[model samples]
Target: MSIIAVVTALALSIIPTGDTPTVSVQQGAVQGVQAEGVAAFKGIPYAAPPVGPLRWRPPQPVQPWSETRAADHVGAICIQPPANGDNAVGPGPMSEDCLTLNVFAPEGATEPLPVMFWVHGGGYVNGSGTADLYDGSNLARHGVVVVTINYRLGRHGFFDHPALAAERPAEEPAGNYGVMDMIAALKWVHANIGRFGGDASDVTIFGESAGGVAVSQLMLAPDARGLFAKAIIQSGVPQGATSRLDIATPSGPPLADRGASFAALKGVPADGTAEALRAIPAEAFLDPAPNFGGGDLVIADGRIVPTSIEDGFARGLQAPVPLIIGTNSNEFPWARADTHPMAQALTPEERTALIAAYDDADDFQGRFISDVMFNGPARWLARQHAARGHPVYLYSFDAWPDAMPQPHRGAWHAQERQYVFDTLSTSPWPTTARDEAVAKVASDYWATFARTGVPAAAGQPAWPALAEGHEEALVFHNDGVAVEAVPNAARLDLIAALLDRLKAAGLR
Candidate 1:
């Protein structure tokens, strides 16, 4: 049955039947569900499944469906490690045919609203857009369209090999299938979001952690230009995060070399064909021993990611759009108290200066790791973007919830997500009155940013944009929001200086 024929038949069958929202996209018509004043479309295939012969190739167009496909529930999540009681991939079963996205919009929308596209983070190895914590229904109620998408994960998403390269067109991308999936999804949204009352020209791409890293890469990607007008990166881009496609770097060997090693481990010859590599069962790659997609997930593949993020920013090559980049107060708890790797990079005098600045060795160790890995890099990126005369906002989230276990020191990585999405009700931790209040403010700020390019929440401190020398950040604490100097600036500056030295010497 052809799509035209299906549409003709559907019109005869009382198409759009009552209040169910049905949208016609390039592929075909899709019927969605409505709830709580929000119309949601889930499991909408933006591209064909990357299975069988299409295993590693860039996303291909989905075959046109002949009928109004039901998009009531999310599609299967991409293959990943089993969740340890954290349903990271949502309720859907795991499979390779997981390139689907969901959209949440006000059911009574009368005009095109700003679009907020969300990318999920899981170390580039796991996670899906279907997770309950990521539901955009509540966020959509704030006068914007919200979208969440699932890209390929693990080896299925980011693998490279000579055979795969040999078989592909010279211009096609390799080793960054996940990145390609994101671009494809964005293109789909640009073409189809208007049907859901979303302004395609006002799309703001945002994400947390690896998703945030993806947003940064997208800003650096030439293919991703003009696809979005704004970006928000949360705890992404630890300094020196990029890798090479075919050469060794201080971070790791070429991704192709790793792929060849994995192929050899799976009993394929070093010169194996792409067919043999794709023949290996997807589940076989899930074994923890091989670490198929581990290490340096983003690669400078020349076509997609042309250069390292820092270098791109330094060279003024990043997308000249509004930016919001930040990190958590305690991204990682440092266990080693006696010695820290950062100290090795410093001289005796520098170490003495750091010790004098921060008295407690154990506390310094933990904050040092967080600063070097997350906070410092965020500030540096914010500075670089701001230097380019772009509107840049930097924030540090330290909102510890009451439901958190005893001795709650500070907000941990990704904790701001619940507040950002106003989804505290989904948390296993009991939601307190203060938590709900913070969530309202947090979501308001995010949604407002998507609408106006400025983050403003009612009854909260106005979030300020970063300037060349003014290194201020909006602080989200347990009590409420406040504008303050970036915490740990002195330590972060020292670490940044050491990291610069290491990068110059190619030793980081």
Candidate 2:
């Protein structure tokens, strides 16, 4: 068959047959499938394909369709490096035209339910909403509508070339296209989620790792205001070493310069134009070589992200919504002692004294780095929000499930996701009665928060909001979930001081 005929056939196949569940979104009608008391609408386009001229630009409205479109199969995920043995990318076809989202709602729901929109994390380079780990079925069954999205990844999603910036209209923002895509998705939800048995006005945006960072960024994003009613950030905080939104220096060369540098290594020009860069295949930019000055993921273009997170919080510019933010017990055990910022900033005597205070000499470096990078920032954010009178619930995930091969690493980064999503059966680790019990409690907390802005479950202890004299966190452990005072107060203070010194020295 001709290419046109093939495309037509593929489009036609998406339309659901008689008796399938259907909903009318802003763009068009989508037919979903029902199973196990849940209605799931998959591969629903939220925006126009970001291909050709649309590449690197803010997401545009998806073209409306007339006929009922099939939303049964998963959509293609944004272009990303294939996962190694880790199954990091999960399961999904790869494509540039991947601006789609999935919605899961309880079947036979007559009233609109709270919405939980999730953003998956892959170091800002990989991960997709279609990942098996992000299945929203379990969450939807808890009387909440769940949604997940796929945005651009790697350089295709976040490039900052002078030529591209100059070519665009002066009013348009440059860089951070991935974040722009997310804003567009949220806007779509605000306009259309009601049709899927969801309360558009009661949406809670939650994400892990890079997704959590996006949540933090969205809190301060002017355009994202009113898009989400609440936010949950897990194992990701916008402070310490990863705080800077713009990896490129203001006076430094654009990311294209680094691309040119990489091209030069391959016998190409050292300075390439925007048109020249665009003409290259998308896969060329996917090379894992050190390009674009290394750290140019999210740029603070004064548009999407107006200012530093600290400055925004200090100025009371963050969204006044209830927040849930916390980190795992062991964030990164492979960290090296010499690589930590405090290692270079502090004198030998100070470093010795700090390690002695922690009393875990062998693992002090990893613990200290984890605190400075993740734990400290999380607590600081909670305090900032509480000081501003916004209710903030904090937690620490110390539960090591039987599935963890490296339990000694403690409750490692991103481990809370399974429990929060109640997806332990799909994970590699063996599940115990306690694991299932904890998963239910964790997932209940999330669903409850989405419904009422308070993280509470029926049998779980009362989780207090962080305040001046009431600094506490709901500790999620395998033995039992309980409320406790914030852990490692003095050590966190030391890490905070070290970070201050580093920032003062312009080393951050």
Candidate 3:
């Protein structure tokens, strides 16, 4: 047997399993199984399926069922391309009827506990909450309730056709249907989480990558106000001017134009209605066209994401809540990575000036990408939260798994997940005692943050709130977790200056 299987079996052997646990939600009673001291309720429908006539529309209420429903297994994931090596949580069979969520709570809990609603990341294209990497059992064992949810993905989730817009009610805005599905799940939690021993008023929405972007978006979404009390953004930042709601410059086409282009590719005429596009098989939209390159599908629609996220933060319109945000040490390899707007705009002289401080030319690109895309944005958000007088804790994950053959691999994107969820055994990498130690610390920090606004535990280092001059963050390493000043601040500052120069030149 695999090490993970052996570990899982050993873990399961300790907890006695017997009588199934049942909880009555708003729709009906759900029967779940209890194992390892946690009650797991899976495949609970939070919204009606967006299929057939309801395609591309805002989520509707689920029909109630009188008989007890069995929420023992996960529902179908959203439509997307099959998973590959790049996407560890490979795609499974998908269906339109996939708007479901899972809840994990401490068994025999006398009162409602804090809720951590997780959003998985897949670049707004793929991923499901049911990914094995996101098992909440270990986290739930810490006495907090955990929730994982699935929303629409790719074109099916974020499409905006002019004909469709015209067909919808005047009051309901179009596009960002995936975001709408998240809001629906949150609303359901607010109404029914108490039944699962979760405190609705103490919801903490957390996510990684695209999931992090969703959390940031939720902070700006007016409809999402009051749904969550705390937020954790991992390796995600807000889209700047490129995603403004009202702007439709050549560089950033309006939603209707984007829809028209996509429909044209699908052989639908320019004047074709939304129904024509919806009638096409869902699979037709899953695969990217040969050499197809496009802008973000998760754009700001007037109703869901009212304004540019940057504008919202500048105007202090974001939901004022305690936040913990950070990124990995090495987000991605920067070699020939000319895709970033900053990278594309940088002159040779500007590039030379930016790289002068770094000794290793080989690693410069990776570090630059990490700083510009993930670390810099995270710090900017931390500063914003601090300036607004909200509690904010920043972090940098630098721990490398000993199981990997490469010795110098810094914490790459999504690596912190195994530690944060205390599921190191399930990871493909061969874990060590140091990994377990880090996992305990990271998971405790997360659980503590969910319980209270502060991300502190009895034995771990005391994480301080971000403020002027004291711009410190907790660095997670294999050796230990410690509070230290932000690393590579000078290099990041240089990159930020170049980006400012690009903005002044009107490149964006």
lDDT of each: 0.83, 0.79, 0.80
Tens digits of per-residue lDDT for model 3, 412-442: 8888888888988767778889899899889
Cα distance off (Å), candidate 2, residue 238? 1.1
Candidate 1 residue-wise lDDT, 1-508, digit = tens: 3342233333332323335788787899888888888888999999999999999999999999998899889999898888776635688688999999999877655556789999998888889999989899999999998999999988889988889988888878888899999999999998788777777778999998889988988998899998898999999864333567888866557888878888898888769999999899988778766684434666888778788887888888999999988999988764442455566767677767776666576567766666777888899889888988999999999886776775435677788888898998777678788988888888998999999999999888888899766778999888889999988888787777877877687656
> What order do candidates take by TM-score, descending?
1, 3, 2
Between prediction 2 and prediction 3, the one with superior TM-score is 3
So what's the TM-score on candidate 3? 0.92
Tens digits of per-residue lDDT, candidate 2, 402-442, equal 66776254788888888888888766677898888888889
TM-score, one value per model: 0.93, 0.91, 0.92
TM-score (C-alpha) between model 1 and the true structure: 0.93
